[model samples]
Target: MLDLRSLRQNPQAAKALLKIKGYDFDTLRFEELETQRKSLQSLTEELRNERNVKSKSIGKAKAAGEDIAPLVAEVGDLGERLDAVESKFHRLQEEYQAFAQSVPNLPDASVPAGSDEADNVEVDRWGALPEFNFEPKDHVDLGAGGMLDFEAATKITGSRFVVMHGAVARLHRALIQFMLDTHTSKHDYEEVYVPYIVNADSLYGTGQLPKFAEDQFRIDSDADFYLAPTAEVPVTNIYRDEILEAGRLPIKHVCHTPCFRSEAGSYGRDTRGMIRQHQFEKVELVQLVEPGRSWDALEELTDHAREILRALELPFRTVVLCGGDLGFSAAKTYDLEVWLPGQNQYREISSCSNFLDFQARRMQARYRSPETGKPELLHTLNGSALAVGRTLVAIMENYQDGDGRVHVPDVLKPYMAGLDVLDLG
Candidate 1:
């Protein structure tokens, strides 16, 4: 959630910044609501003060040996008025909160001005795109012979799903392990195991609720549980409604979990393979740091994600997302697009974002500032160290030989128990 004080103090500046992200700040509506809220608040306070004054007068009348009936009746009336105004004030506050929650975070000043991914700026590229003498096939075609079974998955669950068998399945698992190990050991992130299911509050804390409800796989239970959309959600929410000491300023966690998405908006895109799936594993990296160091933390975190791609020997490029391409909660974002021989283009393998205090404010996650001796919101950052399925897809497409065998990346060989090649023969 945005700081209401800042928005109230400078709605015009906020409106201009939000416009870059494709959000039109409803200043008129906000003003109307704010006006009413202020009026109701003022009335509520006045009534409470009047009631307190009148109630005290009733005691004075009683002590003076005079009939206190009139004063008692006046106090009762004031109490009734105060109750009505307070109730309205409470309701207006809720309305204001709803409006506030719908607004997206303002993009950072450093973020480039653009409307979409086409305008995103590429900052760096790594490795060489694999060259294949034979015509490279997409993951769907490469994993055809019972290795990547979409048909069986369709029969069991539906579209946008896949079941990997034999070596392909092992490769998928190995990618997860490799990513988790890399992030935990080399990147200094603590490994965490979080629930695959979460509540509505958890979703809201991560800026996925209220706006992207349709994109979630919500459970039918009365408890309002939803399938984890990404490990980022559960992992970052570990400090929801918490405060930490200055010494614990930077908290980093790496989590591996199965992510579920309804893909409600992305109906037809990437429907052919594991590129888009209802169920896919991911190795997610999350960090909580003091406010001043967040920008540096973002660079460090993006490098940590890039390390995984580097270790796997995958060619990839890093692009800074433009203002309009930024995620709902992120002030800035860097998307890592890995090269795929089959697709003949780079596809996004991970997104590293600095949410600043946007998510921390929403989660009420804070830390005491050593300098001020006061609690302040922490800056939260998270990234897909690598999306496991996409990494698997990249490996298969890049490592395929003329004979149709998939050579495992050197980094994952130990995780695969010395298995160097994947042959469905």
Candidate 2:
């Protein structure tokens, strides 16, 4: 939510920045509401003042032993009018809040102007693509013999779900452990555990509620809780409504959790294999920093994600998301696309974004500066060090041998209990 004072000061300037995120708020309605609110609030104050004066007059009249009844009647009438004005003002305030919630956060000036992914600019590439000795198999073909069972997952949970068994399931766990260890140990992030379900306020704080609810799965029960689409929700909101000291400027957090998505409206897209699942795992990274240092943090954070790809020797490229293709909460984003030789394409394996203070403002997450002794919003950022399911896909396709076996990446060997390759039955 934008500060009310900022809205009143220069709404146009604010609106112009929001245009980069593709929002066109109704200026006339906002102006008209402000006018009414001012009038209505003034009226309420006047009625209260008049009643106070009349009450005093009535008390004095009684003390003087004359005409107190008339004064009492007049004061009672003033009370009724005050109630009416209070009701009106309350309604107007609610309307204004709804309008404010509908407005998106403004984009940073550094973001490129474009409407879609095609317009995104490539920032850099990482590692080298795997050189295969024979035809490579996609994850589905490679895992089928080892119990990466799609048919069973469908029977138990329906399509867009996969149930890995035996070594395949253990391999998935190994991938998550490897990524989490790297993020927390070498990358200097604090490990955290967060709830898988959150309230609407938490969603709104992250800019995922109201606008993107359709893409999510919401509970209709009494709790009114919604299944989180990503760890980004609970992790990013750890500091919601919090005030941190300036010295605590950049707080880093890394979390690993299973993500659930309805994948609504994604019909006929990546429907094959585990490429696009309704439930998957991910290792997430979050940072809270001073406004001046957030951009630098963005680059550093992007490198942190690329490290996982580099260690695995997986080929990947980083691209800057143009304004149109950016997430609703992000001012700018860089998606890390990992190479998959089987599909002969680079698939998005991680996404690093700098949301600036957009999310912090919504979350009311702030830090008090030591210099000014004043509190200010801290910039919040989050990125997937790697999406576990996608990383699993990348490894399988990249390491497939001619005999229908998959070689595990060296860094993942410890977690895999010294296993080198997963051979088919």
Candidate 3:
């Protein structure tokens, strides 16, 4: 949620900033609501004060042997009026809150202006695209020999899912382990295991609810639980409604979890292979730092994610997300797109974002300031160190040999127990 005080103080500036992210802030409506709220609040306070004075006078009149019927009636009427005005004020406040929640975070000034991914600016590139001597096949074709089974998965569940067997499955698991190890050991992130299911408040804290409801796999229960869409959601929400001590200024956590998405808006895109799946694993990185340190944290976090791709020796490019391409909660974002030989293009493997205080405000996650001795909202940042499935796809496509065998990246060799190649028996 945005700071209501800031919005009220400078709605025009807020409106202009929001426009870059494709949001049209209705300043007129907001001002009207504010006016009504103020009027109602004043009236409510007056009525309560009048009631208290009238009630006291009634008692004084009774003590003096004077009839107090008029005073009693006046107080009763004030009570009724106060109730009505208070009710209206509460409803209007709710309306205002809903409106505020629907607005996306304003993009950072550094973000480039664009409408979509095509306008995103590539800031850097690492490693060279591999030259395949043989025709490169996509993951589906390469993992065809019972290694990546889609038909069985379809029979067991549905489409947009796959079941990997033997070495391929082990390799997928190895990628998760490798990423977790790299982030925890080298990147100085503490590993955490979070619940795969979360409540509505958690979703709202991460800016996923009240907007992208259809894109979630909601559980069929009265508890209003939903499948975790990303480790970022549950991981970042660990400090929801919390105020940390100044000593714990920077908190970094690395989490590996299975993510579930309904893909409600994506009806027919990337439906062919593991590129888009309902169930996939991700190694997520989340950080909470003091307000002034978030931008630097973003760069460090992005590099941590890039380190994973670099370790795998995968060619990739880092692109700064345009204003319109930025995620709902992110003030700024850097997407790392890994080269896929099969797709013949770079596909997003990780998205490192600095949400600033956008998510922290929603979550009410804060830290006490040493100077002011008052609680202030902390900055939140999260990124996919790497999506396990996409990383696996990149490995299969980029490391495939002419004989259709997948060579394991040297970094993952220890995790795979000396297994160097994935081949069908």
Candidate 4:
């Protein structure tokens, strides 16, 4: 949520900044609503003053043995008028809040002005794209050795799902364990386990409720339960409506959970393999830090995600998301694209973003500032340490042999029961 004062004081400037993110925010409507709210507030205050004076007169008349019926009647009328005005005032405030919530965050000045992903700027690349003597196969073709089964998943649930078996299933689970262990032991993130279902307020705090309703799976329950879209939603909401000491300014948490998405807008994209799935597992990293340190923390968090790819020896590059491609609650974002020899291109494996208090404002997550002894919004950041399913896809395609066997990455061997290779023999 934007600061109402900022919108009221300089709406034009806010509009200009928001336009860069491709959001044509209506400043005029907001201005009109604000004006009405101010006017109503003044009238409400006036009515309260009139009521106070009438009540005083009633008390004085009663003390003097004079009839106070008329004064009491006038005060009652003032109360009725005040109630009407105050109700309208509150309704207008809610309207303004809705408008503000619909608008996306203003992109950081450093973000490139682009309309789409094609204009995103690549920052760095690591390792070499793997080469195969035989024409490389996609994950679907590579997994035909009885380890990956989509037919079973389709019958059990529907499309955009997969059932892994034997060594492949073990590899999938091993990937999640490896990621959690690395983040907890080496990256200094406290491991967390959160619920797979959440409420509407949690979604709103994470900027997913009103805007992306179609993309969520809402359970048919009394409490309006919705399946978690990502671990980011639940873990970040842990600090919602909270104020923390300055000493606890930075809180880092790593969570692993199954994410459910409707994939509403994506009609015919990445419909093959596990690239785009209704259900997928992810190792999520979230941070709440002092505002001043968030930018540096973005860099650190992006590197932390890249560390997973590095450990798996996967070739990948980092790209800064352009203004138009930035998430609704993120001022800036970095997407880590891992090399997929099967697809002959780099595919996004993780997205690290610095919301820079955008979500903090929505969630009311704050911390006391030592300098001022007042509460201030802390910057919130989250990134996929790596999407576990997609990491498995990358490994399958990159590590496949000419004979169709998939070689497990050495880093995951210990977790894979000391099996260095996944053979379907």
Candidate 5:
């Protein structure tokens, strides 16, 4: 949520910045609400003052042995007027809050301007695409030797689901373990375990509710729990409504979780395989840092995610998301796209973002400022160190042999029990 004071102080400036994000911001609605709020507040103050004066007059008149019926009646009328004005003021305040929450974060000035992914600027590329003796197969076709089972997944659940068996299943678990281990042991992030289901407040704290509710899978029971879309929701909410000491300026956490998404708006895209699963696993990294250092933290976090791709020896590139491509709570974002021989293209495997203070403000996650001795919002950042399922896809597609076997990446051999090649026996 944006600071209402900032919008009130200079709405034109705010609107201009917001325009970069492709918002057709409504200035007139905001101005009209502000005008009504100020008017009602002024009226409420005047009425309260009149009531106080009338009460004092009544006391004076009683002491002097004069009738005070007219004074009492005047005070009662003022009280009613004050109540009406206050009621209207509260309503307008709520409206303003809804308006602010509905608006997405302003894009950073450094972000490139564009309407969609086509406009995103690539930053760097790594590794080299694999050479194949025969036509390369997609993960679906490559995992067809009883290793990846989509038919069973569909019957047990529905479309956009898959069940991995044998070495492929082992590979899936290995990917999660490898990612968590690397992030915790080498990336300086604390490992954390969080609930897979979360309440609405937790979702709202992370800017997921009200705006993206349709994209979530909510439980029907009274708990009103929703399956987490990403570990970012629960992990980041750990500091919601908290005030941290200055010394703990930066907190880093890495978590692995099963993410569930409705994929509500997407249809007929990437439906052939696990590329757009309703359920997927991810290793998520989150950081909360002091305001001034968040931009630097963004770079470090992006590099940490890139390290995983490098470790897997996957051909990939990093791109800065344009204004239209930015996430709801992110001021800026970098998407890591890994080369997929099957698709013959690069697909997103991770997204690292600097939300600045956008999410902190929503979460009420703050730290006491040493300079001002007051609580100030902290900056929050999160990224998929790598999406486990997609990494699995990349490995199978990139490491396939002409004999229809997949060789495990060197880094994952130990996790795969030292069996280098996944040959269907």
Candidate 6:
């Protein structure tokens, strides 16, 4: 929710920012509504004050043994008028809130201006793409050594699903565990286990509701609840509607969970392998920081993701999203695209964003500043440490030998119970 003061203070400034986001919020109408609401509120208060004065006069007249009937009747009539005005005032406030919710956070002036992803500029690329000897197999072909069964996945559920059996299944589990362990130990992130089901408020707090609900698997209801599309949903909402001490300025958390998505519009993309899935495991990182620290926190969080990829020797690049490509709640975003030989390109595996209090405003997640003894919205940030399934895809394709076997990454060997490679014949 935007601060009501934004419009009350400067409706024009709000309108200008909305334009850059491709939104033309009717500033004129909102200004009119605000003015009308204020007028009604003032009148309602005025009626109450008058009723109080009338009641006081009635008491004085009764004490003096004078006629109080006229005064009493006037007070009763005022009470009815006050009730009517109060109801009207409440409705006006509701209308104002509804309009504000439809408006999104203004894009930070620093954000690049563009119309679409094609306009997104590459901020930086990390690590070089690998040079392959022979024509390498994609994840699907490499895992087809009979353990990774896409057909079985489809039989059990539907498309964009995979059933890993035997050693492959173990490797999948190992990857998630390894990620959680690494993030918790070296990254200073407290491990958290969150719900797979979340409410509409959680999605809205994370900016996934309203616009992307179609991409989610929602449990149909007016009290809208949806299967989480990512651990980001539940983890970020852990502090929803709460206040904290400034000492807890930056709350770092790591969550590992299975995500569900409808993938409604992506009917034809990543149709093979686990690259695109309705269900997949992932480890997410979320941070709640003091407003001024969000940008530095974004850099640190993005690096935390790259650390996992680097540990596994996977090449990747980081791209900054353009204004048009930015997520609804994010002022800025950095996407880490992991190298996938299978797809013959880098694929986005994680997105680290600086919401700059955008989510905090929605969730009312605040911290008390001792300096002024006032509550302030904390900046919220979240990133995929790595999507476990896609990283697994990267590993299998990038580490496949000329033979049918796939060598596990050196760092992941311990998680595999000292097994260094997976042999599939």
Each model's lDDT comes to 0.90, 0.85, 0.92, 0.91, 0.91, 0.85
The total of clashing pairs for model 5 equals 0
- 1-425: candidate 6 lDDT, tens digit per residue: 56778567887897787677677879789889988988998999899888888888888999999998887776666777888999999998888777777777777777777878777778778777877788888978887778889998789987788888877888889888888888899999999888899998999888787667789998878877899999888988989989999997689999999999888988898787788899998899999999889989999999999899989888888888777788777778888988888788888899888888878888889999888899989999999988989988888888888688889888888888878888866
Q: Clashing residue pairs in candidate 3, if any?
A: none
Per-prediction TM-score: 0.96, 0.91, 0.95, 0.95, 0.93, 0.91
Question: If candidate 1 were superposed on the true structure by all CA atoms, what would the RMSD be?
Answer: 1.9
- Count steric clashes of candidate 4: 0
Residue-wise lDDT of candidate 5 within 289-335, one digit each (tens)?
Answer: 99999999999999999999999999999999988888878899999
Once superposed on the true structure, which residue ranges of model 3 sit more than 4 Å away at CA?
Answer: 49-74
lDDT of 5: 0.91
Candidate 3 per-residue C-alpha lDDT over 1-425 given as tens digits, one digit per residue, 9 for 90 to 100: 78888888999998998888877889999899888888988888888788778788888999999988877775665667788888988898898888889878888999998899999999999999889777999988998778999999999999889999989999999999999999888889999999999999999999999899999999999899999999998999999999899898799999999999999978889988898999999999999999999999999999999999999999999999998899889899999999999989999999999988999999999999999999999999999989999999999999998687889999999988888988853
| Clash count of each predicted structure | 0, 0, 0, 0, 0, 0
Model 4: residues with Cα > 4 Å off, grouped in runs: 49-71
* Residue 415's lDDT in candidate 1: 84
Determine the backbone clash count of candidate 3: 0
Best of the two (1, 6) by lDDT: 1
Once fitted onto the true fold, the runs of candidate 6 whose alpha carbons sit more than 4 angstroms away are 51-71, 220-224
How many collisions between residues are there in candidate 1? 0
**Which 10 consecutive positions of candidate 2 have the poorest summed lDDT?**
71-80
Q: Summarize candidate 1's per-residue lDDT along 1-425 as a digit string, tens digits.
A: 89988988999999999988888999999989989988888888888888778878888889999999877765656666777789889999999999999999999988898899999999999998887778998888888878999999999999988888988888888888888888787888899999999999999999999999999999998799999999888988899999899998689999999999999978878878889899999999999999999999999999999999898899999999998899899999999999999989999999999998999999999999989999999999999989999999999899999687999888888988878988955
